[model samples]
Structure formats: structure tokens, C-alpha cells
Target chain A: MKFRSMLAALAVLVLGAAQAQEPIRIGSFLAVTGGAAFLGDPEQKTLELYVERLNAAGGVLGRKLQLIVYDSAGDAEKARTFAKRLIEQDKVDVIVGGSTTGETMAMVPLVEAAGVPFISLAGAVVIVEPVKKWVFKTPHSDRQACERIFVDMKARGATKVALISGAGGFDKSMRAQCLQVAKNHGIEIVADEAYGTGDTDMTAQLTKIKNTPGVQAVLNVGFGQSPAIVTKNHKQLGISQPLYQSHGVASKAFIKLAGDAAEGVRLPAAALLVAETLPDSDPQKKVVLGYKREYEARFKSEISTFGGHAWDGLMLAVEAIRKAGSTDKAKVRDALESIRGFVGIDGVFNMSATDHVGLDISGLRMLEIRKGDWTLVK
Target chain B: MSGRTASLATLAGIVLLLPLALQNNYYYEVAIQVGLNAIVCVGLNLLIGYAGQISLGHAGFFGLGAYGSAILTARYGWPPLAALASATAGVAVLAYLIGRPILRLRGHYLAMATLGMGIIISIVIATEDRLTGGPDGMPVPALAAFGAALSGERVWYWVVGATLLAAVWLALNLVDSPHGRALRALHGSEVGAEVTGIDSARHKVKVFVISAVYAALAGSLTAHYAGFVTPAKVTFFHSIELVTMVVFGGMASTFGAVVGAAVLTVLPQALTVFKEYEMVVFGAVMMLTMIFMPRGLVPTLALTLSGRRLPR
Candidate 1:
């Protein structure tokens, strides 16, 4: 009779714990409307769609998911202000956003002080360098992009390279990173040419590169219209040297804009670009194909790797919350740090204490643009 | 004089009691931004309203002040307070030198000159990657005194709030002074003011320098408070935003400028409730506000409240 009564009491306590309604809050500040909208728009959509699906699956630890997104419009000050609101007012359990390096760095001090786990979607190495306790990122850093390009160039037996960069933040940072790592790869920078932010014509700089001798390959370290313009100018000038680009131009829009000139142009980017082309045995293939299919089906837009970064970030946060089995801030952060062998869209993340951004040189894949589509270089 | 004293006392009371209503650090951040913008707008109002001059490049002075103090304390090892003062004084000198020549041009020509100047400053800041950390922006050290870092949102609120009060006080006094009268006369008509021996050129130059100083001081304080500096504020869009705040607050009114700063600063954050329609709604609100009030929020409301004849 005592055993039966005790069993009834245990059932009542367990049922009560699962019946609570307080939702786990995930806060985000993205550049959804302004300068960096192309990146933030897809990211916002992915997060919203996935969060709905997670909640539909009866959420982690038996709690619903609440996502609060604030668009910073690519403004650093606005990013900081929205971060404060997210922390103090919303009291979110985890933060998994920051589209630009500027916005990411701006929110670093706040999240660290508040002791919230922040997973940055920004591509700057500075976001994870020196390893602040509360910050992690899902994107490959610009330095890694530079190092990867150099190693590829070395393998191709290209001893000399001409860098044509635009003055945008990413362009300049990648250019510097390339310069920093060229010596290590035994590559020499033959000519360094730069175009202003809004310059549509780069034939002037292309002519200079064309005249420079011993330049075996030309690399443009820019993303926006300028890189496409450089591609056209590279073709118009009839310079047959192999062309390379940064991962910044890893979008279908670049192919549409560059058209015939995009043929044979090489760049390093995440495997999410060629998700459908991956083998069945690959671990990341399933995750990448799942995201691409769902996103394409829902948003009716071609998937870009920028959105893949957000997918990685959000899933990591959700996994951490699940691992902790509770919404405790300190415990969740610890769970995030201890995450191992997790496969996501960005890379197979292996986070450790010293390295906040766990994906290394192997995460990036080299691709050649053939007939206006991305093909694995093998 | 009594009215001015009363306004100052009221401002003081509000500043002291505002902390009670602040729920947390988020409110303090918004409040601090409002204070900083108000300091710049108050000085800007003196030039645009009292002097009838338009500056499309005030952000250049503000950016210069920000980068100056940031580089001074971080690179040169100067004390924070000293760097702030020096940056302000440097901008004052630059404004005075350029104002004499640039103020000679009137109306659209003057506007063009200032616009060109702002563009030049922004370009230089972006290009000089070595010293200024290029386009990615540089980190600013925390405001320190006597070898101790004076940090935290609440502490900055007191500092910026006190500075904003001082800026308004100075603007009010200037408007009531002899120079202020001259500026107002010049705004009415340069020839008429010159006929009355108002020295329109000199008064214009002095007020220009004064306004630039205000922007520089606010910019320096903002750099220290945010603990980061970027060229984002130095752009032409930011200068236009400042002008919009001045016009929105009701030109020539010090308290109106403060209200304008607060409203515009808070509106963007509040409009997030509308989600995707934020920019559209922001534009609509700005348009409707301008359509109805015309003289801006404070002045139109003041006239309505006092039962005065609406100015045609």
C-alpha cells in the first residue's frame, strides 16, 4: 500500500515539471533592412522557420521557443542599443546573431558583461580571437580564407599573384590577411590594385595588372558589384590569366551579374554552395541538403552560404540548451563550449576552451565557376 | 533671466529623477544617446535657427573629435579628460579658420561647401588605415581618471546628462547675448544687420566655431562611452539626421531640440514592434508629423497650447 502511494506522488511531481509554460528566449540583432540586407534577410527567415519547427517538435527540455529579432540596419550604434534591450529587457537565454564584424564586435562587451552565450554569424577573425568566454562564431574567418587561397595557389604552381581589391570592409580585411600569409605559402604579390567603393569601371586597374609581368593569376578580394565588374573588366581587357575571388561573391547573384565572364573563376567557400553535389556518405551533406531544400521550398529563393552561418549558429545554441537540460545561463554556456563533433551547415564544429571558432583550414572548399554554376574543384 | 533660470532648474530636476524610472541598463543606453544627440542639436540649432545658416557637414567635426580623442588617449597615452578638451579646441580652431571663408558664401553655395568638406573628412578617415584602423574602425579605451577606469552605463549617464545640460545652458545664454542678437539680425537680413553695425561676418564665424565645439565635445564623450569608434557617424547621412533632429524639435528652441533628439532616438527602437514595416512606418511618421505640424513638434504644440495665432 505504501509503494503504491509513493509511486503516485512521483508521477505527480514529474508531470508538474513538464507542464510549465515559460519559453526559452533566443534574442538576435541582424542587419535585416539596410546595407547588409542580402545576408540578414535569409538569416532572419531561416531562424524564424527553424524556431517554429523546433517549437512544433515540443521544444528542448519541454519548453517552447521564443525568438526576438531586432534589425540593426548595419549600424554599429544601433546594434549596441538593441543588444542592451535584448539582454536587460528580454532577458534572453542565448544570443545567436550579429551579421557584420562591426556589429559583432560592438555587442561583444555587452554579452560578456551580461554572461550570455553569444554565437556570432560575422566572418571576422577578431570575433573569436583572444577567446572571450561568452562569444563563439559559425563563419570561417577572413584569415582562413586568405590562407586557403594561398595554399591553393601554391598547389597550382602559381608563384605570383595580382590582388585587385575594393575598399569595402571585407575586401580590405581579406586583402590584408592575404598579404600577411603570402610569405608562408612562398607566393609573391606582384601588383596590388584597389578600386573605390562605388567605382563601376575597373579597366583602369586591370590595364595596370595586365601590363605587370610574371602575374600568373589575378585575385579580386571584393564581394559587391565591384567584384563582378572586375570580372567583366578582366574579360574585356582579354587577360587570359586564371582569376580567383574571395568567398564574398559566393552567391547566385554574382553569377547572374557576371554571366559569361564568371566561367573558370575560382573561390573558396563552404560546402553548402554545392550541397546537392555532395556524396551520400558525407556527414554535412544531410544537414546542408535539408536546410537548402527547406529554405528553397519556403522562401523561393536560391540559397546562399550566409544563411548557412545562421543555421549553424541557431542549431548550436539549441543543442547547447538541450545538453544543459535547463535554461541556466552558466550551464548553457558550459554546454556550448563542450559541444563536440556536431555537424552543421558551416562545418563540422569541434569547439574547445582556447578556440571559440572551432572549424579550421579544412572547413573551406575550393570551387570553380563553370557555365554559371559552382563545381567542386577536386 | 527668470524664465531661463526656471528652465535650467526644471532640466536639473528631470535629470536627477530620471534614474528612478529607468528599469535597467537599456533605458540608460537610450537616455545617454538622447543626451549626446541633444548636445549636438542644441549647438546646431543656434547656427541654423538663430543665424539662418545650414551646415551639411557638422558630422565631420564630430568625427574628427571622436577619432582625435580616441587616438590621443589610446595611441599617445594622454589622459581622457585632457584629450577630450584638446580635441574640442582643435575642432574649434578648424571651424574658425574655415568659417571665415566658407561663411562668405550664402545659401546653396554655403551648403555645397560644407557637404564637400564632410565628404573629404570621411574619405580621409577611411583611407588612413594605419592610424585610424582604416574602415573597420578602432577600439577606444575606457574613460579614465587618476589611473582608474570610469566605466558603466549609469556612470556615463551622469557624465553625458550633465554635459548636455551645460550645452543647453550655454546655447540659451548665447541666444540672449549681444552676439546672439547680432546672429538673429543677420538671419533676418545681412544687409540690414550690417547697416546696424552688427558685424554679420564676425558673428557668423563665432557662432560657427561655437557650434562645432559643441559637436566635437559630444562626439568625444560618445567615443569614450561606447568604447568603440567607427567612421559610420562621419557620413553625410548622419549629418542629415542631425539636421532632421534640429528641424523636428522646432528650430530655435533649446528644449525643443532635446525633445526632438529623444523622440527620434527612441522612435526607431519602438517601431520594431511593427516588424517588416519599420522603415515604411518611420517614413510615414516623419512625413505625417511634418505635414501636420510644419513648424515641428514642440513649436506647433506650444502655439496650440498657448492659444496663439498660427504663423502663416
Candidate 2:
């Protein structure tokens, strides 16, 4: 019996080795296991859906793309180690994920040293600006999001505003950019307040904002339940100012978690949410609807701009691998840098060697939650 | 005396040889981090295991060291090594002042006070944008010793391993000495140790300050290696994580602390298979370890080997 068992184990090991040699490996580190799981879980699903679709379409360069994802749990050091393991041990063709700028930045040196093409899902400018040759991003920068929001605000005549942000990497960058954009647009920021990531109550900050004079719009620049808190508090305190949220609050999960308070908040988001509202005659409408339909059909969950970023990231990686015709890091990086007019879920992405952020503010559309449904604000 | 001397020699030998053996840069990076964690855990063991105290606020000291080194070098143009030394010293003094009143509290009260301290530190780091770069974190000066950037992984491995060896040697010697005995007595029975002429409160405070200095040094080293520092490093959860390392390894055993640091650090990497279930698994591990191996991994194993096995 012992001899038989040993023989079976040996056979299984041989088969495993053979199968491992066939797949072209890729890796990413997400926050799937941490408090950020609310975001990372959807990001993971987005990657999985892309991988499935690509593999079914004969994959890139005729090699099956195998994604090996690690959970950084929103910690920076863990992200670094995962990157090392991916580059050194797994020998992946490319890397393509990060849930936050801090976690993404932690792996910058490692990817640069390994000379692999890294596409970040994180939106902070620090991840792409001061761009290393190997790193690229698919998500619109926080600055681009800020510019888009201000464009919509200018249209809405929300010239007087207040800013509130959580104390984290993404929130801080968005806050700074919002202030800068407001300055550039000749609008006034009447009040500013802050909260930590885990703070359950933000009433004090909201109360301060509520009492601030001449504030027409309250811009909440953070993710998770904070946008809802801001909206709820605005109504509870009987503050009549329009609440304009950043793209971080674009998730349906945000509204669901925020309950009834999430109704009527406005924000600038990617074209994904307003697909149904857009005219069939519009050039982007078909692509947006197709992606939304396919993503929803596969995952059975409502997709957000956050997942849209992941889709863009994965599709770009696949395209680069196809163009390079090989998994060599240098070749793949050149392929990514030279990519042009790639119609993505968010926008038409065009990459240049000097500019790593492929998409700009033109990709965003003004959106508002009216009667608990996202609608394109004309 | 012979045992102490031999152990010290062993530590020195390992420190000297580890970098040479770990030619791969990835493992070298891991070694550097393990050394840094060991340094902090040694001090933590002194507090929780020796002095009969608990703290969930060491991340505050850790952050202080990181921010202190970062601000001094980046803002004030101080030399990196000098800044690190000052940072460690500053955290030690802060810990000394804080330990006086907070150490007087017993049990969970002390834990909560320390937790508050960590939260305050992180908040200050996050909010003070102009000074500390806000929550986006600030860049740190590279550790350059006498004109050379300490960029190579092998070089860092040796530097951190040597630091850990020295810390382990000192802690071991301290744990075996008369002062060590007094600490253990206090750990066993604080009132009894006081009754027997030991200055329990003073010893507790001293160990608390020592532990904080160790954590500060570790934090400073880590900041230089990463070349960045964020408020995340100083968060209350991070303080709890450090405490978890000490308790998970075995409070009374220095080897246990090292083992604990290594296991906890590596476990996340191995558990990548679980994907979204990773946190659930990690929480389960913490709960089971506390319930089953309350004395921690090292001491429990030691007891089992010594024919004093705990019942399953």
C-alpha cells in the first residue's frame, strides 16, 4: 500500500511539472484579503473575466496567459515581496495590478530592476509621474479625474465648494488635485475637513462643512462608506448644498452601502455607468454597452469605473504581449509604450514613451444618482 | 558563562555568513526585514514576557523613528545615520516620558492607552501635510554610510543581520542576569516582586523605554530601506501586529520572537492560494493559536519536547 501511494504521488508531481511549463505566467498583487477587499474583490473578478476571455480567443502570441495574483492586503511591504516573488520565482511575462498608490509605489523599484512592463490600477499621479521606463498605467490619474469633475461642476455652476477627504494615499492626492483644479477653474473652496480611513463617524467634519457659508457644492474625495456618510449627514443636518463626490464614489456598492442617503449625489465617472443613457448614435455607446453586457453576463454583478480601470489594464497587457510576440520584458515594454488608439472601456487609450497615463479627462462623463439609479447628467 | 559566550559567538557567525549564503536578492531583502522585525520583537519580548506588561502602541514609536529620520534628512538636510541615531534617541525619551503614567495602568487599560498613542501618531502624520507630506507619505533619504548608497541587497542583509545579532546577544544576556531574574519575578507576580524589595514599577518603565528604543531603531532602518514612510506604519493596527508577533512566537523566548516574525511574514505569501479568503484564514489562525498555543509556538514546542506536552 505504501509503495502504491508513493508511486501515485510521484505521478501527480510529474504531471504538475509538465503543466506548469506550458503556461505563460503573469502576476499581480491586490488587497483581496484586507479592509480594501471591498474594492479588490471586484478588481480580481475583472482580471479573471479578462483572462478567461483572452484565453478563449487563442490568448496572446499563441501562448496561454496564466495570472498568478497575490493579496497584499493593502500593505506596502507585502506588495514589494509579492513583486519580487513574481519576477524571480514565477518568471511571469508581465505584472498588472495594485489597489492603491502606496502599494503600487512599493513595487516600483522591484519592477524597474526586473525590467518588466507593469500596468498599475491605482489612480494616484505618483505611481506614474516621474515615470520609470517599465511602469505604465491604465487608470486615469487623480488629476485627470479632478479636471473632469471640475468641467462638469463648471457646467453645473457649482462654483462655490467644500472639500472633505479621508487620510489615505488616494484620498489625499484627489483632495490636492481638487483644490488645484478649483483654483485653476476660478472657483472657491469655502471649507475643508478630513477623516481617517476607519473612522465610523464623520459628523463633526460634516457639521463644520454644513455651517460654512457660501458653499454650494460639497465635494467628498474618498472611497468606501465616506461618500454615503457625507450625503447622509448633508440631509440629516438639513444642508441644501449639492453633494458632488469624486470618482472614488462611482461604485454601485457605495450607493448600496450608503442606503437611501446616496440618492441625488453627483460625480464625474467613466462612460461605463451611463451606457444605457447614451444615444446609440454616439461612437462610444456600442463599445460601452458591449463591455457592460459581457462583464455583467460573466460576473453577474454591476460593474463600476473601478472595474473599468482593471479591464483597461488587463486588455492593454494582453495587447502588449501580442504585439511583442515574445515574453521578453524589454520587448513587451516597447510594445506597451508604442500602443495607440486602443479603444478601451473608459476611453481611446494612446500611449507615448514620455506619457505613461494613456487616458485623459475626455473619457469621463458627468453622472448623478437620481432615484437610486445612475443617470447621465446632460 | 560558557553558554552565554558560545551563544554570542554563534550569533556573530550567522550574521557574518548569512549575506554570503543568500546570494539571491529576494531572500536577502527578506533577511533584512526579518532582522529589523527581530530587533523590535526582542524589545517587545522584554516588556510583555519579562516585565509583565502589554502594549498595543509600539507602532507610535516605530512611526516616530521613521518620521524623525525622514524629516531630519529630507527637510533639515541632516546626515542619514545621524538622523537615525537622533530619531532612536528621541523615541526612547518619548517612551520614557509616556511609560511613567501609562505604565501605571494594568491589563487592558494599558493596552488601550498604548492603542490611543498609536492612533494619535498616525493622525498627526496624516494631517500635517506641509511638514510630513500628508497621507501620500514622504520620501526618505537613502542610507549612505560615509558616501556610498546602501542599495545592494547583500550589503543590506549583512547590515541588518549584524544589528539583529547584537540585539539578540544583549537581550539573551539581560534575560539571564540578576536584572533578568527581577523581571521574571515581576512577570510571575508583580506584587510579590514588590514585596520582595524589587522596584517593580521602575523596572517595568525601564523595560518599556528599552523596547520602544528597539522598535524605533527597527523603524528607522526600515524607512531607509524602503526610501519612504507613510502614516500606515504608525497606525494602531500596526502596533497590534507587532504585539501579535511577540505573542505568536513565545513571549519568554528570543528564538520564539524571531521564529514568530519569520512565520507571520512568510505566511501571507504562502496563503496566496486562498485569494479572497486570505484574511479569513489569517484571523482563524490568530484565534486558534491564542486558544491552543497560548504560551506561543516556541515555548509550546519546547514544553512538548521536554515531556510536558500540552493536551490536545
Query: What number of clashing residue pairs does each candidate have, in the order they appear?
Result: 0, 0
Candidate 2 Cα misplacement greater than 4 A, ranges: A1-22, A195-216, A236-241, A256-263, B11-23, B273-294, B303-312
Query: Once model 2 is optimally superposed onto the true structure by TM-score, how far is the C-alpha of residue B215 displaced, in angstroms?
Result: 0.7
lDDT of 1 at B119: 90
- Model 1 C-alpha lDDT per residue in residues B102-213, reported as the tens digit of each score: 9999999999999999899999988887777767678888989888887999999998889988998989999999999999999999999999988888999999999999
Candidate 2, CAPRI quality class derived from DockQ: acceptable
Candidate 2, residues A177-249: lDDT per residue as tens digits?
7787678987788898888777877889988987888888888898777677777877788778778888887
Q: Name the 10 consecutive residues with the lowest summed lDDT in model 2 chain B.
A: B18-27
* Chain A superposition TM-score, candidate 1: 0.93
Model 1 stretches with alpha carbons more than 4 Å out: A1-19
Q: Which one is best on lDDT?
A: 1
Residue A154, candidate 2: alpha-carbon lDDT: 75
Backbone clashes in model 1: 0
* Model 1 whole-model lDDT (C-alpha atoms): 0.90
